[model samples]
Target: MTSFNTIIIQNIVESLNVGLMVISHEGKIIFLNKAAGAILDLDCEQHLGFGWGELFITDEKSNAQFNQVILDVISQQKVGLKHIASYTLKDSTCPKKLSITSSYLTEDDATLGMVFLFEDITEIFNAEEREKKILSRNAALQKERIEGLDSLSQAVAHQVLNPVTVIGGMANIISRKLPEGDPLIHDVQVISEEALKLEGLVAAVHSYCDIPKPIPVVVSAKALFEEANKSANEILDRIGECIEMKLDCTVDKITVGKKLFHTAIVELLLNASNFTMEKITDVSVKVSRSENIITIKIADHGMGIEKHLLPHVLDPFFSTKAKGVGMGLSRVKKIVFEHQGTLQIESPGSGKGTTVTIELPCPDLSCCSKKNSD
Candidate 1:
């Protein structure tokens, strides 16, 4: 009756879904389920009499791992061991991943041997590896493209500057020589404006290359904005009282490049002022600071950027205006990141207005001093 019951139990175990193998008290391979035979290319009857050490062959890298697990089982290191191994079988075209769980084949707390359950996870690993390679390839391509753009911009900037200066100089000469209200005076003024726009484009490109060289200093956010506001108003008065200031920061001083950082804020303000050309537009500059980050938000109630174009706003030389240089936001983004900060641009649809938020880390004294000296 006992032998009959044992055979019935073994048959029941062999019919399960997972690959199951049982080792006897002498560490011999006593039983293997049907799933185990299929997974391991096992001739169940031939392999039943061998020890645990004579199981399926793992790859060269996993051979020592297999031995270590066996040693751990023999020494009763813990209640069980679970490991995943990939191995090639006799008739296999590719490696198969097996998630194996080995536990003591015990009854009433007595030492029996080990039982292992394995699952084939070959497809899962292959999918993960494919996704990883795709991401790596994309990152490599992006990096290569950026480096190419940087090189090309540098070469073009020098050539652009000389011609722009000459045109600007000629425009000044023509405007001075022409009489007041002359029809050609307006044309010469347009040429001056266009030349200035070109010069600004060159400067924006140069700012990208020079962002790394800023010597950080302790600067007052209040004073910075005050100066920036005055400068922006002077250069951008045509847009009316479009720029309004709101400061809500208790911490006044932040560490950054006074000149370049001021330049960054001025760029954002100018961008807002330029786009709000219709009537007297409202452009607001708000500053808020927290324990860790300082945020400067610039908002404009003007012609907002299009949704499709918004995503590429910070990209170098990206523009929507017929005569836009496309370096304003790009240079602003570069400067904000150099200060260990982030710049976020948000706009609803076209003609709804745009908001740009810049968040910067609050500077620590020792670190600020170190960076300034360096």
Candidate 2:
């Protein structure tokens, strides 16, 4: 009968998935099961008579804390459970996380040694980390989709409203000229112009929503800025100001889709021009390169963005402008991200002017040159 009971106990210990160890009163390991040996990266025979602290190495601070827990368990002569704690093995390649439950062994209510049950939780921890990353990525994608839909709606509303506004203004003007014969004629012409403007706006919205396939090529930064500035000549002249372009980058070329790059630069230029104070003499565009990053900064001396609004500027449909549809900066942000870059806006509250900085990963000139030559 005693032999039968001993066999059953051995079978139970061998079948357990959790690691098990029995420690003497002197903190020495007296018994270890196969699972415990595997966790400590040792054979059961090799682990016997070794100190628990030596088998599961921890820092001085952690060792002190764990010793206190063991003392408390021994004094109370009760079972104690501790949350999973990480331990770095001295000679193992992988870290181990374990939950330890300790209980004192007693014979006729007199204390003897203690038994520790160790459960490895490393795989559970890794799965939780992976799940967190997946959730984070899904959240970001959902936010982008919602923002895109909102921008589309705003663009449509702006397109519809622009023509209606133009037509209304023309109707008011022609009301006084009704007696001059062709009263409705001027209104009709105005409506046609307004309709064309709306069509152009709608086209911009379509292009923004359905991005074209990328045609990657090396584009000259200096040449692109020069062309964009020239296109904005009329606006500069009307505003009685000059845009100063400071090109400090040695790497003149970047790999990008030419048309999209051109549009991004133009949009930034237009934004700068529109936002500058009339008395401000210059809008500065500075280009520089450092390490493997290319940076472009556009600064305007205008009534700067409000401090509270700066955080939300890149959000779709969020605008400080009285008349804007608020998609310009949002579109710029999207384009910069597509190019593996970041866009940041800095301002000192309301009256201090604003600066928009764009940083893009620099292209490998060697590879680009080889491709171009080929």
Candidate 3:
């Protein structure tokens, strides 16, 4: 071919979206297109004239299989079409899926080299994997919800109510009969406290089961924070503990269930108050929009959770505190989920502080308008 034609062909190959590579029968890489360099995560300019094995070989055994496929195509002098291979880069810990195609470069019955074409299919593979996981998770959640309802019902009926009532009544009668300063008075008080604890547990269970469906409305973000602040402050005042909650929100307005959102914030505030008894707590709130999602982040510089305990923090009845019923965060998560939002809790180890984030979709206003009209 003429030099100009060769240059034109090279430019065309370079401009192609799919990765292209040419290796001589001697196992030397003669040409590496830009796309190929990017997909394989290599410097194309330096790799020319280098052995193909130098780039493809890795500690990961998957590369060996990939190399074997290339060898098979060359030995059989056949086209390898749509060969899906797993490739692990030298510096990356994750393996990537690549769709590869190979064909021999021949001239008049003489095979000179081979051309390999490939593209990174990692994102496509990952998306399918994610869908599978979500489907499996939905099935598990369905089973869990049924079992949980049955268990909660049995406990409330047969185990908790009757026993708690008898223990509390007997403890009160015994306390009334005991004289002042009697040592038995302390024992009676202990029984009363235990009974109260059980009663509180029952109330928590009822609250968890009774969360109503949210009615979403577009409301001012500032107004929601103000209302939650007022309610939280009142509870703080009754308890005689003064903790300051400072909020910095950039959001103007959002579409959410007003009452449910308030509950979620207050629950977080109360939980934060537990750690900030000795120090002032800073509650940082920020709202930002990305694509069709709006994210609200609430962060506090209080005693954060430990790494190992973070995973179970959302589990119902799981508590890190001695007297905690562990339903507070659970209720908050339920409220967020019902609103079609996701709740995430992250901490920078113990004592470093924690951040809880809520992400909700930014609904098209026209849809809301149509709903209102109907």
Candidate No. with top TM-score: 3
Global lDDT of each candidate: 0.78, 0.72, 0.83
Residue-wise lDDT of candidate 1 within 1-374, one digit each (tens)? 57988999877877777898878878788888889888877888888988766664354444455456566666764665787776567755677877778888667988677787878888887898899999779757865775687778888998899999999999999999998889999899999998998899898788676566468998777898878877877776763554665655555577888998898878887787678765444667777665556778888887889989989999888988787778778888767766767889999978899999988876675554544475
Error of 2 at 231 (Å): 2.7
Clash list (residue pairs), candidate 1? 242-283
Structural similarity to truth (TM-score) of each candidate: 0.59, 0.50, 0.61
lDDT of 1: 0.78
Pairs of colliding residues, candidate 3: none
User: How much RMSD separates candidate 2 from the native structure?
Assistant: 16.1
Off by over 4 Å in 1: 1-17, 56-76, 79-81, 91-93, 105-110, 177-184, 209-315, 319-324, 328-374
**Residue 65 lDDT, candidate 2, scale 0-100:** 44
Residue ranges of candidate 2 with Cα displaced over 4 Å: 1-204, 210-213, 238-240, 278-281, 288-292, 317-319, 363-374
Point out the worst 10-residue segment of candidate 2 by lDDT.
Answer: 61-70
Candidate 3 C-alpha lDDT tens digits along 108-221? 998899999988999999999999999779957955894587477556745787889899999999999999999999999999999999888888877777787889898988
Error of model 2, residue 362, in angstroms: 3.8
Candidate 3 achieves a global lDDT of 0.83
Cα RMSD of all models vs. native, in order, equals 9.3, 16.1, 12.9
